[model samples]
Target: SGCDTQTVVNNNGSTEYGLFQINNKIWCRDNHIPHSRDICGISCDKFLDDDLTDDIMCVKKILDNV
Candidate 1:
């Protein structure tokens, strides 16, 4: 499904944020979650804006690992 930067969804106990719907439990850090890996190395809120630079960078980082 397509989404925008403002998109946020709760799936089971995990929350997905921003256009990529990045999961707080894995990719990005959310204050509410205590043990997130934060692979993106940035606040989850950074993805929730018009600028896609950080979002794209994070995606690239994610792609590199796989």
Candidate 2:
């Protein structure tokens, strides 16, 4: 079930992105979309980078909440 940073999957009508496969409907937001929790407090684009610094931070937040 693992995927790379550039991997994108369609879940019903929603989108999941990046290595962590973060869901756009909950963890990240699209500019024109609404009701996104965005609990990571970051843009979805940030997770698409290879650096992984911000991605790790956001993953920590997700883990902390679990």
Candidate 3:
């Protein structure tokens, strides 16, 4: 369950962020990218905080969709 909240650039040009490792191409939007689904209705930066309330909520939304 322990994971880093820092942003990580992947080899394929996508970015993963926060404890959940949410991807920019699907769950979150990278400002540099033109398009993203952003199903959680939140910026990727929100998940990078130590407080995980927003991240947990976003995770629930994603789980609901799946």
Candidate 4:
């Protein structure tokens, strides 16, 4: 029998049960995210996280937490 689980926090400040650890890391699918139009003042999570949405408004949520 194989069993594994952990706690993961989302941008909304919610905890999700994480399982199937891969060398102390959990993998999940990322959604579409939009980046800032201006590259100078753009503060999207693109540099840190992938684009989860094609719209800035949608990405804002992830950016807020991430």
Best candidate according to lDDT = 3
The residue pairs found clashing in candidate 3 are: none
Q: Lowest summed lDDT over 10 consecutive residues: which window, candidate 4? A: 20-29
Among all candidates shown, the one with the greatest TM-score = 3
- Assess each prediction's global lDDT (C-alpha) against the native: 0.80, 0.76, 0.82, 0.30
Query: Candidate 3: where is the Cα deviation over 4 Å?
Result: none
Q: Compose the digit string of candidate 4's lDDT tens values, residues 1-55.
A: 0332444445743333323211111112222222212322333222233332333
lDDT, model 1: 0.80
Deviation (Å) of 10 in candidate 4 = 0.5
TM-score between model 3 and native = 0.83
What clash count does candidate 3 reach?
A: 0
Poorest stretch of ten by lDDT in candidate 3: 25-34
Predicted candidate 1 versus true structure: per-residue lDDT over 11-35, tens digit per residue: 5677777787777877888777879
- Mark the regions of model 4 whose C-alpha exceeds 4 Å error after superposition: 1-4, 20-66
lDDT digits (tens) for residues 6-62 of candidate 2 = 646574666676888887777877763477899887788877778788888888888
After superposing candidate 2 on the true structure, give the runs of residues whose Cα lies further than 4 Å from its correct spot. 1-3
